[model samples]
Target: MKTEKRKLAIWMTMEAIEVIGLKRIVLDRDVAEAVGFFHAVIAPQVFATAERFGIHRVDVEETEDGRLPG
Candidate 1:
């Protein structure tokens, strides 16, 4: 028996009153799943950070491209 290997790309953006940043991360299939699971749980804190910064409107853009990994 043989196992197949998979790779993934995860992109995240953070916008706030004082600061804004973008990130492009790559991970294996398993790690990607773990990250996805925690993302929802951690979103509140992320938003809170923006709120603490006095940002009423926080815009975020996220993307994933497994087909184009570099």
Candidate 2:
């Protein structure tokens, strides 16, 4: 089996207390299938719960090499 690169953008921010708000999750075309599979196989409830109680935060970009911006 071969694993493909998944570029996922997750929005996150500090919620009041005891909970971190997980906003919207944008999965690129490469990772859209993976994201669906993950939710279906691993944790289906996560998507629902995230939508219910999470606030949409800022957008984050993902790079393959994981290099810091200079």
Model 1 CA lDDT for position 53: 66
The CA lDDT at 55 in model 1 is: 52
Q: What TM-score, to 2 decimals, does candidate 2 have?
A: 0.21
- For candidate 1, give the lDDT: 0.44
**Across residues 1-70, which tens digit of lDDT does each residue of candidate 2 receive?**
9999865444543335313111232233446654554434333343444457673422224535533222
User: Judged by lDDT, which candidate is best?
Assistant: 1
Q: What TM-score fits each model?
A: 0.30, 0.21
* Candidate 1 residue-wise lDDT, 1-70, digit = tens: 9988764333444455212111222233366644654354345565566576665633334325322112
- Residue 22 lDDT in model 1? 15
Residues forming the 10-long window of minimal summed lDDT in candidate 1: 17-26
TM-score of 1: 0.30
